[model samples]
Target chain A: MDLEDTLLMMPGPVPVAPRVLRAMSKPMINHRGAEFSAMYDDCCEILADVFQTKNDIFIISGSGSAGMEAAVGCTVGKDDVVVTLENGKFGERFKKIADRYGKVNPLENEWGYSFDLAEVEKKLEEGAKAVTLVHNETSAGIQNPAKEIGKLAKKHDALFIMDGVTTLGGDDVKVDEWGVDIAIVGSQKCLAAPPGLSMVSVSERAFEAMDEKGELPYYLDLKAYKKSGDKSQTPYTPAVPLFFGLQEALHIVKEEGMPARINRHATCAEAVRAAVAAMGIEMLPQLDEFSQYSNTVSAMKAPEGVTGNDIKKDMLARGITIAGGQDRLSGKIFRIGSMGNVQPKDIMLTIQELEVVLKKRGVISGLGAGVEAASEVLDSLL
Target chain B: MDLEDTLLMMPGPVPVAPRVLRAMSKPMINHRGAEFSAMYDDCCEILADVFQTKNDIFIISGSGSAGMEAAVGCTVGKDDVVVTLENGKFGERFKKIADRYGKVNPLENEWGYSFDLAEVEKKLEEGAKAVTLVHNETSAGIQNPAKEIGKLAKKHDALFIMDGVTTLGGDDVKVDEWGVDIAIVGSQKCLAAPPGLSMVSVSERAFEAMDEKGELPYYLDLKAYKKSGDKSQTPYTPAVPLFFGLQEALHIVKEEGMPARINRHATCAEAVRAAVAAMGIEMLPQLDEFSQYSNTVSAMKAPEGVTGNDIKKDMLARGITIAGGQDRLSGKIFRIGSMGNVQPKDIMLTIQELEVVLKKRGVISGLGAGVEAASEVLDSLL
Candidate 1:
């Protein structure tokens, strides 16, 4: 049960970098003190670099979903028209959030499918004030066409917001280039930190939207948070130690170089997909053109007569923690993540273990078949 | 900069218990996994015992303020009247949160003072749907009469919500006996865990109100959370590691026994207060009849020539971190907290350090004077 004894292979709450863990264990400081302010300023500055924006960056002391709530709460008003592209669980969640505040125009897609830019553009042309999409859908292991969607939002004068919970550090999320007005990321995903702090970068347009909205419930109000950040503090006491951990994680990301890191993730993801395909299991989204290269995770349909839960349970007994499909696809699809400091060797080990578990659970697959395919993929990349 | 090398003396993010730290450092598990569900269920059960309630208990993966928002969001609808008792900074925050949703009727009191029940009763009599108050106003080191306020809310047939951020584990909060409908506690405060998760126990009556008002924004909607808890999960992914840590911290609390823990806090608070009185520095809330005995923090005025910030800076330089006055009382008062595994030895060490620092800053009339007074107080307790 101890963290030191286990290797987490789940999409998030992945193994934190040792440096980040050490940073989190540092002495607690007063959030309003000058020392903490200095750290806070440096943290935000580096975060802006990671986010690729000049927009204000604020850290909410909560999970990724809290960041989503803050984004929707700050932008959408009682009667606002919000278009949310739903490709997976998290995207559907954005629609639910929009439903809470305003009218939701869902650009719905099947689970394990990517959004069609043309259809989304049609929805935007029909009059939506804002559009929300998930950059990477961890649940279905699909990455939507965020850049195209962002361009479409601009075409119709709609604010573009994206949930980058599982893709921020591992994928190419150039907020400025993508024309994303708001982008949200969490610490526990590709950041390789624990699951507590959520980072949000907001552009000028989102700030103006907040300005036009007079009353927001205090805790989630972007304006109040922005004003407080001017003094390098949160309006309320924050999760101070979590930021210490994040500072170290961001440092690691910077030192590694973002593009190289993203490429590494892409490589790892390709290896995972190659192994899964070798097992004769189909990738959830069959179109190679629509495949996302984020190293975080790969989704595959549970082969006929095999449920995702059965694979998950079998993997668990072998100390591997793969995720089952979420929402509508639960029990039908299986997901394997290789992001967050996971190297090729780790992925190979996982594939080896997975093959063993599958065979032990009565699958007649050859043990080395998956590993050989994954090795070929790795060799090709090298 | 290393955690083990430093002492955390601020009220919250106070030094986490070693056991809790180890627990938090454990490997991450799927939030919906059987192992995590077991931990979650145990934590909730223990939390209910700590709050003295059989009602449903849930944890939000955010800071205490997020819990405050949840309480306010779930119980009140648009245009509902919420009466807040404002004596210090936290009380004012309650007013701000209530104002975000609907009408907020604030029964204002001077800073560094306790609530006047007579005034609260008057406001409640005027037809409010809910009343909010901070059980422990850490800013001013004043604890309000939660039991009395709970009576008023019940009399008016209104939901009674109390913020026990700094009070819950250190003080006696009899939720059932006090008729408190909604009570919130944070992990970092008296619970001796890091700041990430917040625990809330809702009464059947509060659920009734939420059921009647279905307009709550998604994340903060307690009804959605309540429904999810039935499955031993959250509507959104949770901070699983923090929740694991909380389970460990709550276990320690249960093993120690609630009354014993409360008495320990009381004893520590009394020793600190007695020493402060002997130093000839005035306590902020001077009325003996209105004083509360929560063990977490003690608030007092700065001596004639010494500003609170100066005293705090001096303490910080000596490796102690007593807080300066907040809000309106800034630079006029200081606070010292004694809760969560802090002992008399810590109190004595702090007093000795404070005496030296005070004399060095020329703020005290005599050298070793404050230490001697604190020693005498400790001797009397023994």
Candidate 2:
């Protein structure tokens, strides 16, 4: 019940800002009224700034996955070939959704690794309708090569669909510059807003692709959203309260400024990495050539004698909610999120708390070293 | 900014209960955590009571249309024959959605009329994969003969899908007795919650049908929902705040008791009907053999020399929100809603406000006739 006292350090549904929470509590307004239209317009404008795109943005009243489905459902029809890069759970999700509507050639990669650009280009050489990529794979704490993949999509004359779910607001995401034909951002991630809404930006090329594909599933149809969005409306009733929260969240983001926000995320993530390394913990990616560790989330391997669930449970007992590895890697790795409304103080506290858990479990000897290293990072940032 | 002062009497995004607003302000929780699971279980139990079924209830993150799409997308496959009943704008929307997934045989009726059961049965007799019906069409203020349609669907061995967007909680809905295979309800409508989440009840028969149909679009996939729901999870992140609001709204409904709740809605609607009739206004359906007026919303014809938009503008000036006709009926009819957190007093006040607008426009002579009629119904109800 004391939701604010507990720190949500999971990949999403992160600790929301006080302003956003208050915004969500505001009385409901008529969805088709002028007031809602003004709010909608203002939110879209602010979202464009956050997404770093001039393209039209459509806010779906569902989760990030719904936006993912819409991106594919509207463009890829039966028998259409779509090249999907799968490196983590979310990447596999894109493939699964695309498979439902079209023929998908999945360029699979290891969960904790990034895609090989050469192999991805080879897959694209087959000439597909679109190329789908997840910029930040929350499951593996990896950021895929979206910019490179976008280039491949362009070379192959394929529409580039990017899932910026974890990285959009917390990091530098230039959709237009990256040649991302369609980009989707989840509200709960780095946006520091409550979950339930997904904002998508569409390029003219993607619009043309959908037009050629004809009509899509009624609810996921992009054409309907575009038509209604011109009038500051959605084809169906939207989650109005979420929109209010998102607007306030965006205002907070503006106040902090994007450059500073991205830098803060980088600093916090680096501090977490430094502290984990100081505690003699192994990160999941192991500092490979790709170095895909996400600034939004840090996925690290469990200590030799302990499981990730043990760390998660221990953290939860201390009022900090850390995530365990999912899917095939369940109980193998633990993840700490540094996205959204998370501050340096929270990360410093989390690192210190993690040290206590590790030392009590007899996994690490240097109890205070982790906290000290993280503190140094925090102090330098200050 | 003064949202509370402006009465939102639109069919949806209806005025939310105070308790529901407070619930939305609750701090965010991990969507996949134990605490969330407990909340999820509680919400499902409450929703089962509201839907009047022993079937599984799904809380989708999107609006009502997304629920409608899931109901159809999961059951009907491509090239299959689907019988759709269309008597209003929402009915037409159902038809449009079904048409994308299957071959639709639309049984069209007049906008302000209920479906002719015989015609629907005849269409179903043609042997369809599914039959889609809107229990209450909010646009034309019509509640179709869902029980009869459900029976027809069963007789024809077709899946019965019903859109209870506007009627579920405000009116008596017996899902099991009525043989509704899949029923979708919006949180913002009769549920008296904020607009965002949609609750859907699915029967075993519908699930078996979907399994036979193979995979559906990823986000709307019912199987994923069922799988995740078993563990008290959603396939994707949900709107946590909205879920809190819905749970609180359901709790409030339980406190009020169902019989009393249904009676309250009926009494308030009757008051509005009596008041409008006294004001010499023609209700859209004209109270003939097939009365289209809904207990939640009443649609009426615009008076001579006054468009529905004119009335809506006038109402807005007086700090009330009413809906004008949509699509083809635009500017012809106006609708006043008495659903969600609305009470007899709100309806009476709306009628009195309408009388002022009508008198100012020379549409009615007796100024207090409408208010007096409404007050009489309110007194009788009390």
**CA lDDT of each candidate?**
0.81, 0.88
Segments in model 2 whose C-alpha atoms lie over 4 Å from true places:
A1-4, A286-291, B1-3, B286-292
Q: Of the candidates shown, which would achieve the greatest TM-score relative to the real structure?
A: 2
CAPRI grade, predicted model 1: medium
Instruction: Give the i-RMS of model 2 in Å.
Output: 1.1
Per-residue lDDT for A54-145 in model 1, tens only? 88999888778878888988888888899999878888899988888889999888876766677888888889879999988888887777
Q: Candidate 2 chain A — worst ten consecutive residues by lDDT sum?
A: A284-293
Q: Model 2: per-residue lDDT, tens digit, A1-382? A: 5646798889998998877888888888888878889889988988898888999999999899999999999999888999998878999999998999899999988887867788888888888999999998899988877777777888889999999999999998999898999999999999999999999999999999888989787887888999999999988898988999999999999899998999898888989999999988888863346546798999999998899999999999999999999998899999999999788899988998999999899998757899889988877668
Error of 2 at B230 (Å): 1.5
On a 0 to 100 scale, what is the lDDT of residue A297 in model 1? 85
Backbone clash count for every predicted candidate, in the order shown: 2, 0
lDDT (tens digit, per residue) of candidate 2 on B211-262: 8889777888888999999999898898999988988998888888877888
